[model samples]
Target: MGLTQRALPDTPVGPDAFVLGRRRLRSGFRRSDTSRFCDDVWRLAPVLHQRQQASLILNFPAIPARFRPAVKVLFYALLNNKPPAGERQLGVVTIHGYFQAFKEFLDWLDPQHHDRFSSLTPVDLCQFQKHLLATVSSAKQRANHRRSVRLLWTWREHLADDHIPVDPDRLEDDWNEDNSRARRRENANPRIPEQVISPLVVWSLRFVDDFADDILAAQDEWLALQKKTRRDSHSGHGARRRLAALMRRYQADRRPLPGGTEGQHGINIRHLAREVDCDRQSLMAPASWGLIEQAREDVGVDDSTYLRTEIRGLLDGEPWLKRISYDEDLVVLVRILTAAAYTLIAYLSGMRDSEVKHIRRGCLTTDADRTGKITRRKIISMAFKGEGTPLGVEATWVVGRPVARAVEVLDRLQPKRQRWLFAVPPSSHSHKAPRTTEAKTTKATNNDLNLMVTWINDYCRQHGRTDHIPDVSRRPWRLSTAQFRRTLAWFIGRRPGGSIAGAIQYRHLSIQMFEGYAGTSKSGFRAEAQQEALLARGEGLSLMVDRHEHERLRGPSADEARVRLDKFGDRVRFLGKTPDDNQMKKLMERNDPRIYPGRFVTCTDNPNRRLCRLPGEKDMNPDPGQCKPLTCRNVALTDSNAQAWLQRLAELDARLQASDALAPRVRVRLEEDRAEIQAFLTRAGVLEPADAST
Candidate 1:
C-alpha cells in the first residue's frame, strides 16, 4: 500500500514557532496491512516520497522533543526510492499522537534499530521490552507499549506470510504473554479481589428505576433479535398501542431521540470541557455530565444555579448541601433544633428518652423559686455537654423564665420517679416490647421512617415546593438519619460567631450552606476548658514553667492518676491494653478521641469518663456480659447515687411507655428502648437476674 501524503505548506499557519518534522501520512497503512497484505503497497510509495521532502524542511524544535528522531526516520522511509521488498516502508506515524510517542519509545529502546521490517531478533526484542517496562512508570503506558509491540509483531507475521523473508523474531512476540502474566499477578497473590463499581453504572441502575419499563422493553427487543424469524401470529395493535403511550411520555419529557433529536441542545463535548474545566471525551461518555444533568432536571431540581452548585459539590465529593428557605419551610426549621437535640445530645449524654427527653420540666430549673412562673428558671439538662474525662461536662445553658414555666408544667405532669417531660402514656401505641431479631434493636424501622419521608414528600408536593430535595435538578427528597450528623458537622464547622459573646450576631444567616445543624461542639467545649486552665497558670510563667506546670498538672497526684487511670483501664479493659498507654495510643492512632493535647487526661482509662466504652471489648467477648450501672468518680456510686440512678431509669422507662410518646405509630419504640436499657445495664457492670428473659 502506498503511504498517503500531502505536500507540506510552504508556510506554517501557526505561530513562527510551528514547524513540521519529518513524518509520514499513508493510506491503507493500517498496522495490520503488512507485506502479506500487498497489492496496495504501491499506492503508499508517493505519499512516503512527499513525507521525506517535508521532513527535510521541518524544524527540529517544532517537533516534540521525544518524537524528533522517529519523525526523521518516518520521513526517510517515505523518501525511499526502491520499493521495499520484505515489508512495505509506508510512513503513517502521524495518524495518532500516541503513535508518535510509541515510535519514540521504540527508538529509545534501541537507537540502531530503524524498523521491525528490516531485521530483528527475539533477544533484541526482549531487551527492548525489558527497557520499556523498566523505564515506564505508569502501568497503563507500559500496557499500551506492549499492545503496540504486539501489533508490530502481527504486522511482521503478515509480511513473512507474504513470502517477504521477514525475521520471525523481529518485533517483540511475547509482549502479550508478559502483560497477561503481570495482570494475573496483579489480580492474585496477597491482595484480595476488590470490587470497584463505576459511579456511572450505579447511576444507570438508579435511572433504571425512573425508566424501567422502557429499559425492559428495549432489552426484550434486543433479546428477540437472536431468535429465528417467524411469521407474525398476533396483531400489532397491542405493541403499537404500548409504543404509542411510550412515545407520548417520551415526547412530553423531551427525551433524546434516536440518532439525537432535531432540537437537541448543541453542547459540544469539547465546549462542555472548556466550560466545566474537565476532559471533553469524558463529558461525551455515556451517563456523563450532560446525561446526569438531564436526569437531575427530570427529578425537578431545575434551577441552573442549584445545578451548578450540585455539580461542584459532586465533583468535590462532599456531601450535598441542603437548601433552606425560611419563607417556604419555616415549620421544618422549627423542628430542626429539637430533632437534632435527640440525635446528638442523646448519644453524647447517654440519657434515655425517659429521662433527659423532657427539656420542659421543673427539675431542670435554675432558680430556687419552684413557682410555675417563667422567671429566672433554666433548663439544666439542656445545658449539659459530655467529656472523655472523669470531670464530666458542666451545664452551659442557664434557665430563663420561659424555660422554667415549661419545666414546671412538665414536673407537674411527670411521674414521681420519671423526670422526662415528653414521656408517653402507658397506653401509647409504641409501648410493646420488641422481639430480638438481628443485632439491630428495633425502636424504629425503615417502614416508620419511610412513612415520615412519604409525609414530607407529599407535603412538599401539595405545597408546589418540589425543590425540597437539595439537588439542583431533582425533587423526591430521600432524607436519612446519616444526613443529620453530616448536616450538623457542616453547620458547626462553618458557622461563625456561634460560641462566644461579642461576636457577629447571626453571621451564618446569609450563608446557604451554613444553615444546617446548629449544635455546639462537645470537643470544642472541652478544649476551651483546657485553654482556660492553661491560661489560669498565668502568662508570667516561662515556657519551662508552662511545660513543667502542664506535666505537674497531668500527673494526677500519684494515687488519683493511678486510680483514674485504672478506672479508665477497666472500662476499656476490652481494649486489651492499659488505658493510659494503649487507649491513648488507639485514640491517637484512629484519631477518634476528640480531646486536645493540653486537655485534662480525658481519654483517661476510666470507663466512667465518657458515655461509651472503649472498643475491642466486643471482639474479646461476643456474648453479652453481666449488667452494671456505669460508675464515675465525679458522681459517687454510693447507695444514694445507685438508688437515684435506678429510680431515674425506672422513671424513664415509665415515660417511654406513655401513650403520647414520640413516634407513637410504631409499636417497637418502647421495646427498642428496653433493649437499649439492657445494653446499658451490661455496660454499667450490672447483672440482671438469671431468670429474666429480657
Candidate 2:
C-alpha cells in the first residue's frame, strides 16, 4: 500500500496525502475509489482536523473495532495536515470528540452477548435507545449522545471507501442500514418547531430610547447611588432600597409636564428625533406604532405619539409595570417598559425565548461577570439561550437609567420563588383557583399587543360598550398575535425603497436562531400569518356585506353576485385558499333555517307548537314555554322569505340611488346598510321589509 506509483502529481492533496492515500487503498484499495475518496476526505480534512478531540476519536469504535483504528488514523492524518500553529483547533477537537462518543455505544454492544460481528439486532438497538433515553440523566445529554453516533458512522464510511482493505458494502450495511442509526437520526434531529423570541428586548429598548436623556441621567445617578450605598450585590436588602430610590427619581424625571408637550406622553419629540436619527416629520408621520385613535375625531396625534405617550407612561414608575393592576397613565408606562426590555435584549445580547421566559427575580445585575453564573451563584444567572445551559452576558445595558427604572418596577412586582419578570395575573376561571406564587404561575407568552387588545375588548364588553367590540364579528374581540410582533419587526426592518415594508431588522440574529425547526424558516411564521389573514378576510366580508345588503337582496339583478364575487374574490383569495371561503359559506348556509319560523301565527287548538302557512311550506316552531327558548327558531326572515323580500330591498335601493334630497353620505350609508342587513337576514333565515318608519 505504501508503494506510490502515481501519474497525476498536480492533484490537490493535503500534507498527509501519502499516509491517507495508502490507508484509503488498504481499506478498499480500488484505484478510482481510492483517488476520489482520498481527495474528498483530504479536502474536507481541514474542517474535520479543526474538530479533533479524544472523545470524538473514541466514538469511532462504535463502528466495530475492525473499522475504528482505520477511522481514528484518518482523523489523525486529517489533523496532522493542519498548518503548524496559527490554525483553529475547534474543528479538530469537535471531530475527535464526536468519534470518541461511539466507544460508549460500542461498549454497550458486548460481542459476548450476540457476536455476529458484534452486531446488535434491531430489537437490541431499540433496547439500547430505550436504555439511553431511560438512563441518561438529561434530555440534552441523550440528544448529544445520539448526535455523536451519527458522526461516527459518517467518519467510518470516510475510512472504508478506499486505500484500507475492508468490505465497504458490509460495513455500510452494519452502520447506515441498521435500526440504531435510524433511531439515532430521529433523536439527533428532533422535529420540534422553533418558538418565536419574546418581544421583551425590542419593547424594552424602545421604552428606554423614548426617555433617552432622563434614562441616561438616571442610570448614572443609580450607579453612583449603588457605589455610595456599598450595595453592589443584587441580592442584599440595602441593594434593593438603593435601587428603589433610584427608580423613584428616574420615574419623577420621566413624567410629562402637564400641558407641556404637543406629541403624546411626555416624550420630548425634539429629544426622540435626535436619538432615533429620524426627522421630526418622520417621527410624527402616519405609521403603525402610533395610537389608532378612531374615537377622537378632532385629535391629531399620530400612532407614534400615541405609542410614545403610552409607553413612556408605563415605564415611568417601577421596573415591572403590571397592565392589569395599573390605571390608564400607568398602563402606558408598563407598555414602554415591555417594549424597551425587548429591544435591549435583542440588540445588546442575543438572548432567546427560553432565556426571556426564565428571566426572573435576581436574574439581572450590574456587576461584571468574572465567571459564568450558575443557578447556585448569587450573581445574575441567565437561562441558557441554546438549551438549559446557563449563560452570562456582562452587565452593560443594566447600568442604563431606563433599565434601572424598569428593573425597579419589575423587582417590586416580582413574585416570591421563580416569579417571571413579565408575569401577567391569571384570568378568572370557574374550574381553577388563581395561582399567585411565582413558582405556581406561568407568564403570558402570546404577543403583548394582542393580549392588550383582548384585555381592552373584554373590558369594553363587560362595561356595556358597543363600538369597542366590532359589531361585524360573530364572536367579537378576536386577536391577531402574529401581526403584533411581525409588524414591529417589519416596521423596524422596513427598507427605504420597498413598496410595503422590508423587515431587515434583527438580521444579527442568525437564521438558525430564528428558525422554528432546522430546515423550514418560514413554516411557523407562514402558519401564523394564514390564521390572522383568514380572520381579517372574515372581518372584511362582514363589513362589505353590511354596506351592500339591500343591493344584494334585490334579486341578483344584472349579475350582481358575480360582480361582487369578482371584486372581493381576488382579495379573499389573496388571504389563502378560496376553498376555505366555500367551506365558510357552506357552514353559514347549514346553520341558516330556510323558513320563517318566527313569523308563524299561534294556533289556539295546538298551544304546544306554532303553525306558519306561508307560500307552500308547512313548518313547526315548538314553544318550550320560555319566551327566549332555544327551540323557538322563529328568526324574522328565512331564505324562503327572501324572494318575497327582494322587491322591497330593490325598491329601497332604487330610492337611495335616485335621491337628490338625502345627504350623499346618508344615501351611500343607506345603500350599504341595506346590503349588509339583507346578507345578515339571509344568513339568519330572516327576510322582512325595512321598518315602516325608515
Candidate 3:
C-alpha cells in the first residue's frame, strides 16, 4: 500500500503522528509546475526556504508570464551555483531583497514593455537608476536596488540573446558627476569596550566553574520528568486527576488555561502534557475521569510563587526542594544554564556565530604529555568560513580551561543521542517529538543570546544584584556575535596595562598569539584592531602635542621635540578632529611622521634619519622596545613620563630612609638607581636646581 493511501489511525497517538499524517496528505496532492519550482528552490536551500516561498508567492505572479520562466531560471542559477572566492551564497534575505527590487522595476515599466523581451533599453535602465536614487532614502539601499536591477538585466540578456544591450555600470557615470553621495558607507562593527567586557568575562568564568553542577542537575531532572510524563500519560490511572489539578491551579493564578483557539484563551493541553511529561490524550479525558476538584482543593498554594521560592532556594545552595515538582522548575533552570554556557563559550573562544553553532558533542578533547600532564585543550568543529575547498571541512580552536568546562556542561545537559552541542530539543507539545534535535542556526543563536542577556539582567534584579551588564551608549548593548572576536583582538593587540589574569600582565603577550582570532577578512577583527591601534597612536600623539603647546615638556631632545610637535599640530589642524578612524589610518599609512610609545621616550623614528639603528643596515622600521633614549635623537620624553621617573626616585629614596636593616650592597644599588633617574631628569631640564637641592 502507498504511504499516503494507508489509513491514519482513528485517534492519532500523539502530536508527531498527526503532523506526519497531515504532511503525507499534503504531499499526495498534485502541485502546479510553478509550485514545484518554488518547492525545489526551498528544498535546495533550506536556510532561506520560508523567505523564498514568500517572495515567490508575492512577486512571481505579478511578473509577466513570458518573464516568469526567466526569473525561475535566475533563482535556480543563484541557488545551485558556487559563489566567487571569499563570497558566500546569496542568503534568503538577499534573494527576497532582489525580488522586491525586480517587482518595483516591473511595476514602473509600461504594460507593453512587460512581455516585450527586447524592448528594454539603456535609457530605461538609466531612468530606473535615477528613480531609485531619488526615491530611496538610504544610499546603501539605493546601491542594492541598482545592483539588483543590473543583475536582472544580465540574466534577462542571457535568457534572450536579442535583448537590448544595456551597460548597467555606465548608468551611474552619466547620472551624476558627484559620486560621493552614492558611495558605499562605512559600516564597521564596533568592539565591546573594555569596561563592559571585563566584568562579563569574570562573571562568565565564575558561572561555568562554580554553578555548573547545579545547572547540570536541573537539566537532568527536567529530562527525567519529560520521560516520566510521557510514560504516565499512556497508562497511569491517576494521570487525568493530576493534569486537572495543574489546569485549575493555572487558571486560578490568572494564567491562561491551555489548549484553546488562538492558544491565548487558555493553556494548551499538549503544552501542559509536555510541561508535566504526560501525553495529550491523558489531559483530554473528561473531568469525570477522576477526582479533579478534590485534587485542585488539595493543592492550594499559588504555583508561580511556590516555583520561584523553590528555585531561589536551590540557587542559594539549599538542597533541591524535594516537595516542589521538577516539572515546575524546568523552564527557568534550562534558560539560565543555556545562557551561562553560551556566554562563556562565545566570549572566551572568540569563535564566529557560524563556527560556534557548529560545535558538536565530543568536540572538546584533551592532549597530555608523556607524564600525563595535560598540555593543550582544543575544540574540534567544522570551519564555516573559507570552506570553498569542500563543504564540512574540519577546524580546531585551542580553548582555555573555562571554555572546556562550559562545553562539558553543555554536553552533559544535552541528550546522549544528540550530536550537536547547542541543539535545542523540541518541546513535547511541539509537532515534533522530544529529543528530535536540530543544530542552532546563526540567526536563532544570536536571538537566543540577546534574550539570554535580558533574562540574566532580570534574574539579577530579582536576586538583589547591582552588577548589571551595561549599554555601550544610550542603547542597550545589542550583543552581536562579531563583537566578541573584535573586542578580544583589541585587548590583545593594544595591551593596556593591568593584570589580565592574576599576576600575568597583558603587555607580556605577543601579537602573534592572537592573530588566529583576529582573522584577515576586510570586516573582521584584524582590520578593526589595526584601526584601533591607529586611533591609540593618534590619541597618544595628541596628548604629547597638547603638552608641548603648554610648554610642559623639557629635555635634551626638546629642540627636536618642538620641531616634531609643531609638525604634528599642523597635521592635526589639517585633519580637523580626525573624525573617523580611517582618516587617522590614512595619516599612519604615510609612515614618515609616525610616533610609537617606548619605556622612557616616544620614538618619532624615520628610518632614513634614525639615530637608534644598530650595525646592520636594512629595513627602516623602528624597534621602540630596543630604543636607547640617552643616545637616540629620535626620542622625546614628555613631562608626564618624566614625572613618573621622578615619582619612582622619590619612592626609592623613602625606602632607603625607612629601612635601617637593608644590606650594604642593596643600599648601594638603590642609591645608584635613584641617582641615574635624577641625572636623566636634570639632563631633560625638568628637575629645577632648587628642588634638586632638597
| Number of the top TM-score candidate | 3
Task: Point out where model 1 deviates above 4 Å.
Answer: 1-98, 113-118, 155-694
The residue-by-residue lDDT of candidate 2 on 283-321, one tens digit each, is 454441142122122233222221122212333353322
TM-score-best of 1 and 3: 3
Please state every model's RMSD to the true fold in angstroms.
28.1, 23.9, 10.2
Q: Model 1, residue 180: displacement in angstroms?
A: 5.7
Q: How well does model 3 score by local distance difference test? A: 0.56
lDDT for model 2: 0.36
Ranking by lDDT: 3, 2, 1
Candidate ranking under TM-score, highest first, comes to: 3, 2, 1
Give one clash count per candidate, in the order shown.
Answer: 42, 90, 9
Q: Please give the lDDT score at residue 59 for candidate 2.
A: 32
lDDT of 3 by residue, 1-694 (tens): 2222222233212212211121111222332212233321232222322210222233455565555555555554454444544445665446667877776766777454555545677777777777877787865666677666666555542344433466467665753334434244343456777666665665555556665565565555555544664556344556655666665666566543333322222433444566555666655556522433343344422332122122322434754333323444455445556656776676666566666777888898888999999877778766544554323356666666667888987888777887777776422233153321256555545565676567657756777766666677767677766677766656655677774433323333223224434443222434545556667777667666655642454565556656766777677778666435556555666632566755567665656557667646537567665666655666566656676777787799888996678988899999888776677677677677666666
Predicted candidate 2: what Cα RMSD to the true structure? 23.9
- Candidate 1: tens digits of C-alpha lDDT, residues 1-694: 1121221223112121111122233443453332211121222221332111121122333444333333333333333322345544333322233354446555565456344333545655566667767787766566656544443443432232221133323343544333443453221111100111111112222222222232223323322332322222331433233334533453576542222111124322232232333443444444454453453355422221111111112212432224322122222322321232333232222232322342433445343446754433333443222333222333333322222333343343334554444443121233244422111111332232233344434545665644222221254333333332233332232332223211212223212112111132243322322232233222212222224322232221223433433343344445564333223333333432122121112222234343233444532211112222233221212223334545655766676667465566453666665565445443433426551234
Q: In model 2, which runs have C-alpha deviations exceeding 4 angstroms?
A: 1-124, 136-144, 161-215, 218-340, 343-524, 527-664, 689-694
Candidate 1 residue-pair clash tally: 42
